[model samples]
Target: MSKSESAVLDTRESKELKTPTDLARKGVVEIAEELKHLLADTFVLYIKTKNFHWHMSGPHFRDYHLLLDEHADQIFEITDEIAERARKIGETTLHSIADIAHFQRLKDNSEAFVAPKDMLSELHSDNMQLVKFMRETHEITSKHNDVATTSLLENWIDQAERRAWFLFETLRAH
Candidate 1:
């Protein structure tokens, strides 16, 4: 990079972006931090869902595989919205995989062979946890009078609930 561009990048890193919002600076910071953690957890859950989808096997392999693929896609679709919400409020977000590892509350599965049933159960639990996290974040947004974020989170919470419901019903059917 050129010297001027490098200097600009350094300045940007050191300074908070000035977004014109009615929220107090402290409130904005708090909201951004909460969103960052939520984003990290979302990314972790998305990867785990994908992992299960790719590794799914058994007599019902096709159905389980497709279900997880849909779940993973749904989980991934919100990540960008979370990050962008943080940015819209004049705050920085997670910068790398290291940041995600640091802030993520959900655990990753690295086992070589997770059973299909186990995968469904684990993802169900994770989605439920995500709903809890989103609700907590919603409280913060509401406190800050961030209606936009709260609205977005409401949709996300519903989606997570649906994913959990699907997993639960699938488990019950087997």
Candidate 2:
């Protein structure tokens, strides 16, 4: 697409939503904010998981690397879904690490080579945090009668919790 075309499209969409947009029902504003933060958190988590996958060492390297890769993909998918949800609610999705870093609740790993156990711990923490956030998002959406977003949040919470439990158990078993 041409740059001008894209700009015009963006402007048109913004204009369309400028007229008293729907407030996501039942305090969905809170849910949207939580999802935005969660998306940002997931973005950081996604990059961290990929980094761990690349730098993982030790005896269970193969297993840990593969698991990290899969987890990273899952985190990316969730981030995309959350961004789409933000768009649905008449909010623009935040782009770039800088934007995410400013608003994300997740921690950044700057100059540390994380051990396998530490990687697992980090993923576990993020997963659990997102699950908690999603649960609250789901509750708010349910109250607002947004069954679709509520259902999606419920499923996401379940999956993230499962992934966290698996990682925790793996570390414990070793």
User: Candidate 1 on 1-174: residue-level lDDT in tens?
Assistant: 999777658767878565556788999999999998999999999999999989999999999999999999999999999988988887889999999999999999999999899999999999999999999999999999999999999999999999999999999999
Each model's Cα RMSD: 4.9, 5.4
**Top candidate (TM-score):** 1
Structure candidate 2, residue pairs in collision: none
The list of candidate 2 runs beyond 4 A from truth reads 1-28
Q: What is the lDDT of residue 59 in candidate 2?
A: 94
- Go through the candidates in order and give each one's C-alpha lDDT: 0.93, 0.78
Model 1: residues >4 Å from true position, as ranges? 1-16
Q: How accurate is candidate 2 locally (lDDT)?
A: 0.78
- How badly does each model clash, as a count of residue pairs? 0, 0
Tens-place lDDT digits, model 2, residues 1-174: 999678658868777642123564435566667677778878888887888889899999999989888888877887778887767765666777677987788787764678889888988888888787777778777777767678888878888888898899989987
